[model samples]
Target: MEMNSSNLWVFIETNEKGQAHNVGLELLNPGHSLSRAQGDEVVAIVIGQHTEAAVASAEAYGSDRIIIVEGEEYARYSTDAFAYAFHALITKYAPTSILIGATDLGRDLAPRLACRLKTGLTADCTELDFDEESGNIAWTRPAFGGNLMARILCPNHRPQIGTVRPAVFKKPEQDTSHKAEIVREEIHFSIENIRTKLIEEILDADNETIDLEGAEIIVSGGRGVGGPDGFKVIQQLADALGGTVGASRVAVDSGWISSAHQVGQTGKTVRPRIYIACGISGAIQHLAAMSSSDTIIAINTDPEAPIFKIADYGIVGDLFKVIPEFIALIDEQILTMAV
Candidate 1:
């Protein structure tokens, strides 16, 4: 590895269906800015089986160069195989910087690859910037339990690596007209050397996965919701508006809702078109994750609630009463349209 390369590689992770993850495509949005500042090409690296679909998306999502490795062993994510294959590719390319999504597979694979390459790895970054003078990446992430933001730099290391949180940046507009240089590589690892094997996969029946990040409208509750039964009221409004249900850390901690629905510094970050905060007091950690929403509507009894400060519309009333009225209004509109 010469370490003089002028390319920024974004790892485009693929699922079993060979679909490119949104986080990878989203990272490309930032990749362009970073690469521009560094005066390097933005390259997309796709490793999966039958990756034609993923490759096409990478091209449409604004990758200057696409590197793909297709093999049967990559149909399902294996930490061993992915780490080994990625290690090989990094050695061959020697890219100046690599950005990976902080997904389950990426979290498992990044540190291992960093160890093998003997480089620094930054995890769960919420912001990214390049210092042209120092030729270093300034990775900004939450520190001290989301109370403070820390900017870290790895100056001496070559091929700076970082895993950024999903939805921290929006995906760029798709341009199918643009085409990128595609490079296909054949890299394989021994199946026998893999330490783990997929025996049986069990799905959680109690929890339904929510795409809160992709939702246009989200209705979230906090400690003010009272208890588990209060979420039922939140769900009714969410259902009426065709929105997704979200929760603050307090709600999740109180066992009022599953952790899958949590939104905050420790939980999933979302940027929906409209975010409604119900009975939430707006702690800094909660506000940090959702302040970027396009339109914020808050419903709380206390006029002094911090959430009211950032809300586009703040209703100082009991959510239990305000929500039902909102739902009834939506229902009436639907009935009138049907009539």
Candidate 2:
């Protein structure tokens, strides 16, 4: 199938209740910016049942056009069904670029879509930019355990595809006053065409884990922190800074922190404004996750810790002593401001 359209397309992921996920909005920030730079429009494609609210949210997030495909079969994401529907839409609209969130579902679905479209896809990208000279996208991601950054480009593909880590890009501010044309499309695929069978969907009770990717500030701990008790100080520091707590792979493997807080090559990739590392040695895997932070502060007793190489500010001291003092100062500052 040949596509004749030339717009930027974004895939919108919605919950069971058809509420748009924040990651979709996050992708829209770059999508809209890229569209404007390319002199094209931002088109969002959402697939699910009762997607009116999702379509509305996409428009609020800066989509110039919303394509809603409604069907009960799409209520739960099935790779085969989703790929078929999205493939059809791509053929019809002919977009210049396609962007998806690097979430669990997106990680599973995007590669399948790329295979279906016979195009290359750059996954877990930390940065995205338009090459004005070539009119192509420059997708950058960690190559060798976060030691090197690789920029990828798909020259021959009509619709270049890229999947970005969640929370790497700032979510576009909502423009409720800005409206776009909503096109309700039909999902013509039948149940027989779907390959996967739906089993029981069990919702976890403890889903309140902090999402580090979306966190503006993250304070992470590493082996230098010693034991699980050290996380108490780290958590207090995060609380004082009004940020979330993160951990290195060693901390997570040692059961010092939940896997949810782990940030590294095998864990989540974060691009917060401020990433404070306490007792972290700055392993390449750990750096791969947060080297893109706007400001990086490292605190380790060892002056030669690998983390100091990339840290904008390196503090050589015991985290137990340093973290408490920093928290106290922050508290005092807050009180001073109130006074």
Residue 185 of model 1, lDDT score: 88
For model 1, the local distance difference test gives: 0.90
Candidate 1, 1-339: lDDT as tens digits: 233377999999987789998899999999999999978889999998889998999999999999898888888888898998888888888898999998888899899999998999998898999876798989998877667888989899888999998888999999999899988889997777788998998765544458887889999999889999999999999998889999999999988998889899778888899999999999988988888899999999999999998899989999999999999999999999999
Segments in model 2 whose C-alpha atoms lie over 4 Å from true places = 1-4, 198-206, 335-339
Error of 2 at 175 (Å): 0.9
Listed per candidate, the RMSD to the true structure in angstroms reads 2.6, 2.7
Give per-candidate clash totals. Answer: 0, 1
Candidate 2 lDDT, tens digit per residue, 163-212? 98876777899999989877877866787878888778765343466878
User: What TM-scores do the predictions have?
Assistant: 0.91, 0.91
lDDT of each: 0.90, 0.87
Error of 2 at 212 (Å): 1.8
